[model samples]
Target: MSGERSGDRTERASDLMQLNAMALEETELSLHEDADGRGDPAAAERLHRLADSMTDTARDIADRARNLADPVPERERR
Candidate 1:
């Protein structure tokens, strides 16, 4: 039962990681477009910030997934 629960959690984490990565890619494209003259400087700055936020989110999601997949030692487990 515990193993099944762990498997489910891992799957969920994997899904989240994929979703975040997609979001980061999409945001990066938007940022590039904004810098390519389709958008103003202010708008581009906003897009850049958005992209940075998405990247941070993706990183956080990946980190969480890694932690879920390979948990810390018993003494270090949170």
Candidate 2:
């Protein structure tokens, strides 16, 4: 039903948010490791890039979820 579909969407959004948080944590750890000289500079750079990319993706997912949860006015739809 419609309610079930909405619940599913909400769950998916929650998952995305969790993933975003995890990615951020990973990025932070990578940065810390690099700072401590325990991580490779090149690998740290790659992790930073990946983190940025994931952050952007997460933002897009959040935006989509928000839009889905609260649709725009009919005039704004098209």
How does each model score on lDDT? 0.74, 0.65
RMSD of each: 3.3, 4.2
lDDT of 1 by residue, 1-78 (tens): 465776787778777877777777787777777666644678777777777787777777777777777767898865
What tens-digit string does per-residue lDDT give for candidate 2 at 1-78?
A: 455777687767766766665666667666555645635778667766765675676567666656655667999989
Model 2, residue 61: what's the lDDT?
Answer: 60
TM-score for candidate 1, residues paired by index: 0.65
Q: What value of lDDT does candidate 2 attain over all alpha carbons?
A: 0.65
Clashing residue pairs found in predicted model 1: none
- The parts of candidate 1 lying over 4 Å away from their true place are 1-5
